[model samples]
Target: MIVNSDLTMGEGVIERHEVETFLTLAEELHFGRTAATLHVSTARVSQTIRKLERRVGVPLFNRTSRHVSLTTVGRQLHHELRPAWDDLRAAVQRAIETGRGLSGALHVAFVSPAAAQLLAGVTQVFHEHAPDCEVRIREAQADQILPRIRSGEIDLGLTTLPLDDPDLTHGPVLVREARMLAVPAGHPFARRASVLTADLTRVPLVRLPGHTDIPPRQAGAPPATTAPTAGTFQEALTLVGTGQGALPAGAHARRYYARPDIAYLPISDAPALEWALVWPADRHTARVRAFVEAADTLIHGHGTTRQPPQ
Candidate 1:
């Protein structure tokens, strides 16, 4: 018959290490090996098991110097504990795998140019691997993208820098792209390898209305002329095609809207424009994970030109 002991109840009676030792030994069923696994000597494993038995008021194991096996009580304990431990292990593994890569949807938002240029390849790769996952892309301005991300209206965003908010996580997806001077085919600059920014200073310049702040050059190219302003890429493109003035655009824009009448010349000396990928700090869902992975893989496969800025 088992007897209860008052000494076992007060405060510091059952040591957690003793319980852990029992479970570990039970798993291995070998004193010396269990001891080695636990980084302790067999003597210590024996002492710990004895302590646990006394505290539990039951024999947990049938033991002999040659072999150790579970007693009736030990078998009961194993039956009860095994499933719980298995569950814990499964949960931990799931968490790690989810952290690595798993099934989910990812919503992406981008500015007009980025939407047109970068998202297609990214979506294609993501869908190929995660066929069940869904991707939604929205086009908005820098100001509009962040608010939606903050409000949980979007999962990820691509935009230009100067994001000072601490609630958002952002990384450079592409470095400043050299601005290309886009003109009509008959334009003189179209025949040249590249055009100087200074050459446009006195020329009629078609500019994005609200984006006057955007730098006017390709890498270190000369400065270009500016008309008062035009809003949106479509507006700027339209004005340039009509020969109103030259428009400065990123490399992607030049290729996306390649027109028979329009010609794009590289700017010789302008500061590049920065492109970045951003997401909210607190948003973590399977879909978001899928999107981030797809974006990463797409960026990687594209080689240097498509590589995200470090």
Candidate 2:
């Protein structure tokens, strides 16, 4: 039984069920509908309504054979009680959501240099939203991203798409960079206006390991014969500089990683590199959602429009 704060019951304490029944019936109007809504039988609703009316010493609902409507007292009660109930429910929900939300350190991972740049912007936004929360931004290899997320080593990842995993969910795209070919300055294609996929066979297309398993060269093209070096960003670029092979890269590479020995050639026939935030499907938390929302404020249909190379 609950104390009747609405009505001072000196002799009769109000049962919680009575308030629920009255409010639900008041909203629903029909006894059958109220029963269905409350998952109770029609007889139970009728009995409860009768008991409540007896306690109030008045009719709460006007009933005819065809219809039922709230009485004047019931309307006023509904008006006053509805808002209170809504506010109470909202407060309870907010408390529960806050308790269940992010509380400790969140580890975020990124693969490419472009992803790191995008994540830096996102981190600023995330901090503004959650100033107390610690966000650890870590550089991760392409292959290490999803596995680390699934293993709970990382909370989020910023990586490329065509991520066909059922275990992960990808967020809004943060960048769309044009594909560029990183060629040795000594190569002929490096001087071309724009390179085509057909021109891939004309040079040794170096394969950088730890890529998302997307082929380094177009299908059926001769495999890269550039002397295989340990898979590292600088090592691959060094090979390109030595005229060992040309490498497919994002347009951002030329801007940030520009080198005197390496030339970035725009690939006219290649698709753009799309980057988005990704997280474990089962581990989607309030922090992850908030980070995605923060990213949306920056990227989704907003000011960070793609600017072609100058």
Candidate 3:
């Protein structure tokens, strides 16, 4: 069992500096190092630790002429206090952000033309909710979206859904576009009303760098060993337009990227492509949550479809 310190004593309450010194000394175990890290004198570090030991009624560290290490009680206290200290700091930071009324910059990005158009509507609504918060928007290739979000380069991303990565948090499915097959306009499949999953066996599929939801080579499909790779959705469509390969695309592409040489047909057996707001798993900040709420409002309240920009 652990003895509780009189942390709540009136007027005699333990100060923040005491807790900081205790945790730091517990981690560093060396008096000089702890003092250097806290920018205080070794004597001050010794005084703080002694005061804490007196308060706890036990020594927290075992000291020798050359070695310093945590006592058993010290280990227990560190185990309990470290996470609590982190949570306390985080709560204070959040309070600061909230106190400032969310009046800061929110960085957002979109992965596709359809996503960009939809983001335009979300941004308008977000502004209504957070007038002082500046929403900075950018367009990124599909592969760049997750990296930017993870590295804190961007706060949120509007991109394809069903990301299997554990580090990413996918928000609600804000937009759903029917799956379509983009074939060369003069190809036989273009004259057909729709294409089946089995039909993919006969056509080479273009590879979009980071789009994982597209169908893979079907059971008996020819090996895509020599398939072309596209950096952007438009590039993928262009590959299809040149008869290099067929592309599985969202229905919105037919409207936003209409081309004379490319024909889009419904995929009779494909699932709709889902789009949502994605952010780093550890970065669900107030601004991120607020932006997600705005997006939810746009999709549910307004029933915004993935249509070409008006």
Question: Judged by TM-score relative to the true structure, which candidate is superior, 1 or 2?
Answer: 2
- Candidate 1 lDDT over residue span 1-310, tens digit each: 1112212323446444565577788989999888988788989999999877876788998888688899988988778866765565677666654555545545688876545457777788778877876677778763477888888777788776656788888654644566677786788887899976677675678766334225434556556556645667777777788778877777666657777778888777766666667787766555565666676666655665463211
* lDDT, candidate 3, 1-310, per-residue tens: 1123335423467667788888998888889999999899999988988887887878999999899899999899889988987777777766668544567899999976778878888989999978999999998888888899889899889988788789999788887777888899999998999988768767888998887547544665565433598888888888989999888877877888899999989887877778889998877777888889988888887666443321
Q: Sort by lDDT, best first.
A: 3, 2, 1
lDDT of 2 by residue, 149-216 (tens): 88999988888776878999988777777878888887787678788766766666566665642224
Candidate numbers, best TM-score first, in rank order: 3, 2, 1
Candidate 2 accuracy as lDDT: 0.76
Give each model's clash number: 16, 0, 0
List all candidate RMSDs to the true structure: 9.8, 12.0, 11.4
Best by TM-score: 3
**Candidate 1, residue 273: CA error in Å?**
4.0
Full-model lDDT for every candidate: 0.69, 0.76, 0.81
TM-score of 1: 0.52
